[model samples]
Structure formats: structure tokens, C-alpha cells
Target: MQPNKIKIKNYQLNSNLMLAPMAGITDTVLRSIVRSMDKDCLLVTEMLSSEALVNNPNAKILESNENESPLAFQLSGHKPHIMAKAAKIIENKADFIDINMGCPVKKVVCGGDGSALMKTPQLASDIVKAIKDHVNKPVTVKFRLGWTLDTKNFVEFGKLMEESGADAITLHARTRSQMYADKADWAEISKLVNEVKIPIYANGDITNIKNAIECLNLSKANGLAIGRGALGNPFLFKQLEHYFNTGEILPEQSLKEKIETLKEHLNCEIAHRGEENGIKFFRKFYPYYIKGIRGGGAYRGKLVTEDNYNNIINLLDEIIENEQKILHIHSAN
Candidate 1:
């Protein structure tokens, strides 16, 4: 219930919340929007390959806005030296360098990266120590419970990461085998918190203030890392910050406000990707923006397939109209 500032080595975060690094989702535009809502919350970049950075320092994924500081660049790889090199290359651009060991995607794990690292603790430890040797920035590691239910070595892993010089650890309370299917095991995070000297952030299933409170109470983690829950409602960072500081829950944004925010997101997407590709990229976000609205499922279907930008705007307008009518009817009832 108390607001806590997260101190990662010498870096101090004004807020204990962090935007989890999500591949393909946590790009420059999304980070910028989240920052507009909550300036102090730590923002992280989408996971990038160490190999890609070593091969090309000017990777497009590295592009970021000037305002997105206190940002952490997440790197995914198993090799020690290459990962350290990548970390050094981006040292000036990042407040922290995050190592990815929890991603469960087949393409990533198959190459001895992501959740696969949990199975090789020594190598994972080496990667952390290597990065520490290269960059003076705080080094953090994000990982899941373990490879499977039978292999829930998060407590051991957390200690190892701390010993290997990880300044902080973020634990998504699910095993690699779970693949987000079952409820995250916050109890496991509690175990890790007991074992690690570094700050531990509890992640997974923390979509709202109530969930945040519960996870913190159960895990006693120093902070939280929000991922999928932030998709449609980038306002979450502000909402969480408000609750943590004042203990007053900010009401969720009205339908009209959500639509306006969606428009802003769309405009940014279009500007970044250009008309055609931007509109296409924006399609994937319709469901999150229109979620819970009356008849949103149908509207989402139409919006995703609609290529014309003007048509999409008209469809959003219609959704807002329908939602207002539905709300009015419910009030009368």
C-alpha cells in the first residue's frame, strides 16, 4: 500500500512500476505514449538480439525518441562476450541493460536463449557477469519460474543472478512450459524475493490496481513490470502511479477518452510506418482499444480488415455512438 522508490544500484526510479519489454509491442511509439501518461515510470525497449546489435549498431529497433530516457534496452542472447559487446554499444543510451531469459517463444528458446537459459544457470550467470564487465549501467535480468512445473528453480536462479552481478530481477510467475496458459504463481515470486539480495520485481497478470496490490502483498516484491495489460490502456502507468502515491483509484477513462487516445496512437503509428503500412500495423490494436464496448467484437472485425484510414475513423465513431447509447440505456435501467 505504500509507495516505494526502486533503487537499482546508483539509479533511482521515481516509481516502482516498469513497462515490461514486449517484443513487437513496446516500440518507440508505445513507449512515448506511456511516457506521456507517466513520466517517472521506467520504460523498457522491446527485446533485441545481441547478434543484431553486434553486427549493426544502427539497427532500426534502436531508434528512440529523446524524451524516453531512464529507458532500459533488453538484449536476448546466450553468448557472453557478444551480449557484453551489445550492452557496451548501447550503454550511453540506456539507464539499465536488461537480459532476457524468460521469453518462451520457440524461435528464441530453440537457440539457447530466452526461457532456455533457465535450464543452463551457469551460462546465464556468465552472461550477466559478462555484461557487467562491459557496461557501467545497472544490469537486470527477467525470467520466468523455470522450464517446467517440476523445474521451478526461480529461487535458486534469483540468487545466482544476484551473485552474477544482476542489480535487479523481474520474475514473471509462470514457468517456461506454462507459456502463459495458467494463472501466474505469485507464491514462486515470494520465494525468489527471499533468496535474492537485489531488487525483485513481480510481473505477470498485473493489469489493474487491485491485482497490483495483491501481487505485491503476496510476493513482497520491490516493484512490478506490466506487459500485455498495458496494450490498449497506456494510461495504466499513470493510474498505478496515482494509486501508489495518493491511495486513490483513478476512474478508468470514459469511452470517448479511450477513442481519443486510440486516435493519437493511430496517428503516431501512421506517421511512423507511413500510410499503408501504418494503417496495417494499427489494425492489431483495435481489440484492445474497443474492449468491453457494446458490440465491439463486430466493430473490431470490421476495423481490422478495413484498409482505408478514413473508414477506420468512421467505424470508431460508430462504436463510440453505440457505446454511449448502451450506457444511457443502462443508466435508465
Candidate 2:
């Protein structure tokens, strides 16, 4: 598989794979884990509200590790001036500044932000232009196909973004009304790619190397911006890297390896977010790591509610022991 080099402004990213910015999930700890897996894969910070960041520049979400470079700091807002100001504040810290125009959450849309911007192309273009004028780093926009099926204007939107000085664009390939419910229309991404000259990264429903290859073949995208698919699978980026570079698929992580990685992820979260909140925050991830294992549902049920760190560790250890026993039994038979 031939790879694409994502070029924005003067920066040329080593790999085309991007760890898409996910609200509340792509924090320092998660980025650290993904970074450890593939050093060159692009990492994005969770969406930051321009107003909130302007008011509180020292917010914890702004905190980042040293190695998470080639990182894009994503901002969500409608006001061009405020968005540009926020970009200015983080420009020194970020390799690229990304604007979030694809989020479909009602709270965000009601504020004329996120997917709401898709309906207001003029304003979205202004936001891009403003950020471009203020920051030396590359400016990118992430958006959906449109607000609804009747208004799937992504091709026009992509051209407008390019005219307004957007260095790149990421298409989520779904109408705002869909809200992640149905399949993403990769055909729309193909349309956008045909219309825009700036690199367009396809972003939706890509979970593995197979999906990655299918998406690239279908959309002709320069790269992939993966979000939810990477939730508990930190090794995904490296796996994709290996396949792309060598045309060889790496074996999936064994049960023991998954358990040990989960333990490391937990400890990192605890160190970054402190014990109580970290343990609680980690609940959202237990199901992803234990997804296909036998007795996983029951373990996930207990893990989500268990706030005691030691107990969580013990339960994880128990899972490994049980899996070993099951393997032994199967071998004997």
C-alpha cells in the first residue's frame, strides 16, 4: 500500500494516519498510549471551546505531553474573532490548528457551532480565514456532509474552505441529522476530494487496516482521521502502519497482552487525572478492551461501578487467569 504524505503549510507529516480529535476521550493519557504505539501518527487534542479556552488558558485540557508533537489542537466555535484568538493562543503549542465544524451535539449546534457551521458556509469560511490570518501554523476544518440530506453541500463547502485559506479539510461523510446513526456516505467524501485541492482526510467508521484500505480505495482520500474506532485499541495505528509499509498484517494482541496494556492505560490515566476521577473516567473504556472475551459483559458490569483501584486491578488479573484456564482446557480436549 502506497502511503500519502499529508502536507499543510510548511509541515509534512511523516504518516497520513491521524488520531482524530474526540471530545473527552483523546486526552493526554489516551494520546500518550497511541503515541507509544506509533510515533509518527498524527494526534489531535479533544475539541476545546474557544470561549472556554480564551477565558481559561490554563485549563487542564490544554495540558499535553512533550512527545505528542505533530499534534493538532481542535477548537469549536462560531465567532470568527474569538476562534482566531483561541488559535493564536495555541498556535505556539500546536503543529496544526483544527476547527470543528462536524460535531452534531444539540448543545453545540444550538450555539451556532459544530455541525451548525455547515449550514452557515460564509461564517465557516470566515472562521478559517481568521485563523489563517492569525496563525503561522496550518489551519484545517473538520465538517460533515451537511445539516441534512436535503442540504448535502460538502463539495461546495470543501471548495469554499480552500478559497478561504484552509490548509486541509476532514470530511465526516454524514449529514448532521444522521448523528452517527447510519453508515457514513463515503461517496460524498469522494465528491469532496474531487472538488478540493487541499488534502481531504476521510473520517468515519474506519476501524482496522481492512476498513482503512476500503475507505482509501473508495474515497481517494489523502489520509484517515480515526475517532471512535480507536477507543480501546491503542495498537491500531501501529498495526495500520505495518500493513501500509510492509503489506503484512501483524497478529492481533493476545488476551494477556490486552490485559497488561489495559493496566498500563489505567495507571497513566490515574497519574494524569488523579485516582478517583481517573478510575471513574476509565469506566467508559472497560467494555472496549474486554469486548469479545468470554464473561466480558459481566466483568464490564462490575468494572464500570468499581471505584477501588486495587479491586479493578484484581478483577483484571482474574480475567487473565480465567482465560489461561480456558485455553488450557481447550488444549487438553
Candidate 3:
């Protein structure tokens, strides 16, 4: 009972469940882990600066793994020329080029790009057309409902993207003002679906399988793009894959299993970036992975403050030892 595969233009996306192109989170290591768990899933790179792609020869951030195939490189910029040039540069490396018109970050918005493009329909369309004209790969756009509640222009904007030659569109179901606080409005997503002919991927608030099912049922979208939900749970993609294949919830991860997975993630980060940089980079993920464990906050505080890789490993070993003791006590009782 495998889920039906989706084809976007020339690319045959094996999985309908896609990893949304998160800015700082979806690096090569993370994408590699997710890909290992579900080889069919479409893993996206972080949102790369289009200008940097063209100007910076050291822009190794856009690098992709040979194993992480069917990857889409998401690019963000305001000007059509900058984005077009960026698309041309990555044309060979990336399987698809995704335009970021959905990011609501102040820095991105101030640059007159991201979700700001949603407000300017003509400019958004022009950027899409420019990228499409330049890249041989399929061109996609990720966007929000609109700038504000009063101005929900997704239906019109989606139409503009398709008319301008975008192969697919993903709606993040929240306005720029909402900014991940309010619950996503899937009804608005449904509205956009009725208005567009190309495949639509519903994004935002899909934290679990139930939510994913509800999103697809309510929006009737062709696919789902997972974001924040994947932070500490690389198994999430596997869970969704299992549920979509068999109509049942998979078993939850045990505490020991969770720790081992986190350790693997940390090691991968260390290997991808050097230990010094990896230790600092992985500090942000400590909270997400250690949440709900006893003394989790204390462990996270120590991990963040510790600069040396050996020191961090020693701390993790101590935590694991303490957890084993706790398990022994519970088993005896």
C-alpha cells in the first residue's frame, strides 16, 4: 500500500511527503539522515541567497550529496536577474529550483523578497518567469496566504505562478503576520487548490501523522511539506511513510533509541563540519532532542557552554549513564 508517487514536470518525486527547505536546519547532514530513513522522500536544501550563489565562489552551502538525489535547492532574492543568475549556476547540481516567496523573516522581507513578493503579484510572476526561462529543471515556488489577513491573495498569486510557468506551488497556510504563532488555516489552502491546476503541497502545523492526514483531507492538496515537525525527530518521515503505506500508527521511539539517534545526528554534524564548529552548531538542537527528559535543561545548559568536543561527549555519556540507572531502578520496582 505504498503512497502513489508524484511527478513534477520532468522529475518523478518518489514521495509525496517532502522536507520543507528550512533555512538553518536542513543542512547536508540532516538531509542525509532523513534520506537514509526514507530513500524515496524529497529532501530540500536550506534557502540559499541567490546573490551569494552568483558572487561567492566559496558558496559551498549549495553543495549536494550524490546519495541525496532528487534534491531541490531553494533560493531567495528580490530581483529577477539575481534569482535567474542563481538558478543558472545551480542548474546542473540541483534536480529542481524552488523560489522562496513564503519566508516572513524581517531580514528577508526588508530585502523586498520572500513573502513580500506575495504582495507584489507582478514582481512575483516576473521572478518566476525569469527563473523558469533560465533553468532547465522544474521551477517551484513556496508562498504564504498573503501579506495580511485583509489581503489573502494566494488564489490569485498561485494562478500567476502557474501562468508564468511554475511547475508546482506550496502554500504555507499562514499569513505573513501570523508568523508561526496562530494555527494554520487549511481552509485557505483549500481555496487555493480550487483555484490552481498544478500540484499543490500543503505546509505548516503538520506535527504528526494525524495532523498530516487532516491537512490533506481538509485541503485536498496533492502533497504535504513538513517543517518544524522534523526538528529532533528524523523518524518522523519514516512514521509518515509507514502510516501512508499501512493505515496504522507506528510504535513510538524508546528513550534509549532516542538518545542513540541524537548521538548519530551529533556525530554526523561533527563529521560534516569540524568538531569545533559542529559543537557550536549542534548546541541549538540540544533543547529539541532533550526536551521532557529529567534534568534536560541542565544538560542542555552544560552542553551549550562547553566548547570542546570531548567535554560535550563526556557530558552526554554522563546523561546516558544516569538514564540507565533510572531504567534499572524502574525495572526493579
Q: List per-candidate RMSD values in Å.
A: 1.3, 0.9, 1.5
Candidate 3 lDDT score relative to the true structure: 0.86
Off by over 4 Å in 3: 1-3
- Report the lDDT tens digits of candidate 1 across residue range 1-333: 675799999898898999999988898999999999999888999999999999999987898877998899999999999999999999999989999999999999999999999999999999999999988999999999999999889888889899999999999999999998989888768887777778888999999989999999998899999998899998988999999998899999998999999999999988988999889888888899889887878898899999999999998888888888888999999
TM-score of 1: 0.97
Model 3 agreement with the true structure over 71-186: per-residue lDDT tens digits: 88999998999999999988888888999998999999999889999878899889988998887989999999999999988998899999999998889999999888889988
Measured by C-alpha RMSD in angstroms, how accurate is candidate 2? Answer: 0.9
Clash pairs, candidate 3, are none
Mind giving the per-residue lDDT tens digits that candidate 2 earns over 1-333?
867778877788888889999988999989988999989888999999999999998899999978999899999999999999999899889999999999999999999999999889999999999998898989989999998999888888889999999998889988999999898877668888887788888999999888899899898999998998887788888899888888999998898898888999899989998999999988899998998999998999999999899999999999999999999999999
What's the TM for model 2? 0.98
Top-scoring candidate (TM-score): 2
* lDDT of model 1 at position 101: 97
Ranking according to lDDT, highest score first: 1, 2, 3
Residue 148 of model 1: what lDDT?
93
Model with the higher lDDT, candidate 1 or 3: 1
lDDT of 3 at 158: 93
